[model samples]
Target: MKKLKKINFLAFALLVLTTLTSCKVGRFIVYNFADIKDYEKFPARKIETGPTKFHFSTTTKGKVPEELTVKDKKYPFEKYLADHKTVAFMIIQNDTIQYERYWQKYNEASIVPSFSMAKSITSILIGCAIDDKLIKSVNEPITNYIPELKKSGFDKVTIEHVLQMTSGIKFNEGYKNPFGDVATFYYGTNLRKAVSKMTLKVEPGKQFEYVSGNTQLLGMVLAKALKDKTVSSYLEEKIWKPLGMEFDASWSLDRKKDGMEKTFCCVNARARDFAKIGRLYLNKGKWEGKQIVSEDWVTQSTKIDTSNGSAWYYQYQWWLPTKTGDFMAKGILGQYIYVNPKKNLIIVRLGKSKDKVDWPELLANLGQTY
Candidate 1:
């Protein structure tokens, strides 16, 4: 009877494993949490880099301090980053590399998933689409491109509303809940279907609510605007290639075949290329005398604005940490591309987890020293 009980337990365990692997929420349960390495788990479309590469001027004696203090306690700088699960960190100022470091066996070439930083990139793409005339304007109702959402009363929602995360879409942003809306979008194989079923929780343009759904909706709109071109290809053509990224990166998709990009997150790239994104915005969307995106769009994205229920700290998918013209592209797992145009500075940090650090504040403080 003891042996039979053991066999039954084994069978039950197998069943649980099967269940966890088969369903959408179960995939969330299996993965447990998001990670910098998450790109490995998903299928992706490559954002191919151009033959012309842009390299930051490097120096052996970078000005970064070797130690940092927190809550009146001091720790070695590298130790602090490692303790915080950081894998890659870089500092750039005056168009030169100030400091670059790696931990956890990660290096310059290691790919780190951008997490929500992709939101900022999505915002850039939207701006580019507008500039290219593929998109009429942000004021236009998103229903112009995605009319299917009209059935859900999304006709009143503007692209600007989604860009500001004030769309009032009924979305659960909690990552801890396996059955939540974000989990379904993050782990489910059908992003288009998931987005199509989205309904409004409240009227759009009423309040500021930070949710990933808004960005995904923007992705859908972009897909429709681009028509035959995939969003990834558009990104490659417009940003990646023009930026002269040193390495090829990819945007993770929801499935392996004709899959929609998980544009609410998941841009997998190296530290340098990620830094270039910051550089782009730092120069007001210009790259090497070429206008990659309009300076007006960059101003609109990073400037302080609180109108129409929009939060002052966020606009056009970029976080304005302070009113001093500083902005950042932040990800869930401690990933960041912090840009301070006032100081001509950019800091890139990628980690397995945030480790409870107020990174924007830290990076901003670091900027003051430069």
Candidate 2:
């Protein structure tokens, strides 16, 4: 009887250890676990907007091609959507909704997570600050605005470097690693304190590296520069209201109500509303003939940076394809806002899968055939 009791105790201890380990892993991939059913329900802080809403004119003439070629393999677009676990797919052309579809009970009212696409929005906010003359220039050192970062090894880091993602901060962006900086930042309570712990490992602007820490630092700089306003208010006043976003969006904060936004990720809004952002860029920072973001800033923001080499394939917080006049704002788990100015096209895809899709090629095909 004593031997049986001892074996049971050992089994219970093993079970406890396994449970503890799983909890850690759960915290690490907290952002990765969302699916169509629960994606719209993720926790976030409200970024309230004004009453106006941008309405898109619809057309029945446009249709998506049934199939597309990826890596020389003929794949059906329907199958692709199913395989990728896509929740929403939308295409807008000439300022009209050509096609829009929702799956898994997701509809027009659903608030989808933008994930890293928030990086591009944060970049736009930086441009707005520059436009308002609140920020002198992108060339100015980040420490100029956030003086507390003076000793944080950002002596040579500029706002432009951070916007271009070449800040040289030693950060691990691997989403699979439970102990990495990204996981900690996503799950931690205090964003500023978490990012403040980062240290420099290389000279700023030496090479292009994609790290979430750069955007987080930019968020801090914007907060300090604005003084009286929060980033959310600035976004609402400058971009959201100006563009007439249909639904009020929310940006997830690190803490309940007072903490800073996780600017590297987590802007939640309807998929159709996201299309408006694409249209704003498509029109060269002009919405309804009004220059919302400066045309010069738009041109500069999307221009490719070849200082290091052609290998980086990055612009100011935007991803460029081999083709010119086209750019993309991407996020983890298959969120994309692909804009082709020449074609007057904007495609937005939101999904729960992490599978890699050739966005440029897909856009090229759609532009040619659809």
Candidate 3:
């Protein structure tokens, strides 16, 4: 029986390797985990975006070891790490890398799209804009700067309201069959133009309405405040490098003109470097000795506000789960930077999930096991 079990294990391992290498799924490569460094992959930082000439961290510091089993799961997390569509999965606890694994397809150099997760990343950048004195306050009416907004209902909306998804913009959260305003705005017309033309259906900040329209509106505000500089440039100067992130992340554009980077979604990054972002939040926007995010921003941004039966709520584009001592930067279809400061944990899970897959339970369960 022991001999038979060993044979089956070996055969399964071989099958996995063969499938990953042979499977051709769009831009993804499955079987190149061992030789990940050799896959001719896309650049982590696109030069057109003005990133400070790409810096590669040749030596991975505090590298997480491979093959940690997920306790009490139908399928082990290690198997998910090995075969899931995700390019990378990293878990750090006690400020040490506990588990780090890359798929056969992706490596340190390849970039994974953040999708809707980009909104949370933009939230931090907006914090930086405030810290740098480019923006006076989150409460300032957005129309104060953009005269065109004065005639519309958005004139009453503040940056804080936008960030918290409580802007109360009349929007439907439906995405599956996206004939609605938010969907048409995102998937149909030019994003910036679509948002600029939005007519308010309700008062601002009355209730939470998971609308991307507000974030896109805020993106236009960032463009105005940054002196017409590019999103990538401001991010590079303020947030990206200061965080000690080793790779360059790309942002999706609002239009073919490409200068207006979409804030509600579409930022791509490496798995480990994305973990660095979780670590940055873990350390409260500080890297090494200096403070990158003001203590106030981190405190206020993660605070639970507008509760929904104590499940979770949005604050400054960050998600606050009901469990105290835990806040996360989560994106649609399961891109997470789950940080538990109390437990000294930072986790990154990047993937391509065509269908919904529950991961919060996966991490919450880890809290008990580890």
Candidate 4:
């Protein structure tokens, strides 16, 4: 009887665990990418899957640059990996595999979540729509496609404004507590409605505030703009395949069955593919003899714009590292894809997602050395 009761209790516990996790994950789908509205400004598009794995035992550990001497010689870069409880995968230049090491049991095969970093990729696809003339202009109101947002504070927001985090329309965005607006968006049900109903806290385009709502809004715009097509499809055709990514990638969708993609952050890819995006920028949007993203677009999107002259600012979706041309796509925790066009380098580091603030200085140290 004791044995039978123990087995039953264990079964019950496992069932409970599975239920809670599913509910937590499904919260995102219920709110943001729910299937109800129908709008398509651009022609229909679909997602194209990209490469995900290597054929051999390849590691980026070999590409440590010869010039990687840091300000402190006491800090052995090699030893840093063994000491810090973090995960990192690095690629230098577009084609070179260098210095990929992981801790906390993570490696290239780990399909880790991409926090907000996926927004960078989403913005790239938006730019493609603009280039293809599917989008009339960033200046054109997204409302021209999705009219539901017109009466809301979003009426005044432009695609350009949203891309740069300058959209003044209000959404509380820091992740401090479960009661906060941003936190509620993540944890609460009906995330799309909750976000859409959020009142604009400030005037549009006058200030800089980071909000996941901005990216979510961008996804809604993209969904409406690309009629009958998945953003994934468009991205694969334009960015993924053209860049020669090495493995298949996955986008965590809001609703898996209905194909609602998590526009803000849903990408899962290998470190090499992340490096390819960086390399794409390093090469100024050219890949494999094709001009995927325009050099002019890369320049204008990454150039410092509002709020800061030195600490670096965002342009389009890319973060300017300095007044120089170096740019980065950073996500929650320590996810980074750093690109320097002048140096002909692209570096990627994917790690545990909840420890970014604890190690910004350390990350900066690595960034500077690269």
lDDT of 3 by residue, 61-85 (tens): 6543333344443664566555556
Top candidate on lDDT is 1
TM-score of each: 0.94, 0.88, 0.77, 0.80
Error of 4 at 325 (Å): 1.9
Each prediction's whole-model lDDT (CA): 0.92, 0.79, 0.65, 0.64
Off by over 4 Å in 1: 1-19
Give a tens-digit lDDT track for model 4, residues 16-128.
76564354343333333221111121111233444542222345356574432334454566555445445766756436565666676666665555566788898888877
Task: Give residue 93's lDDT in candidate 4 (0 to 100).
Answer: 49
Error of 4 at 138 (Å): 1.0
**How far is 5's C-alpha from truth in model 3 (Å)?**
60
lDDT score for candidate 1 against the true structure? 0.92
lDDT of 4: 0.64
- For candidate 4, what is the TM-score? 0.80
Better of 2 and 3 by TM-score: 2
Cα RMSDs of all predictions? 2.6, 4.4, 11.6, 6.5
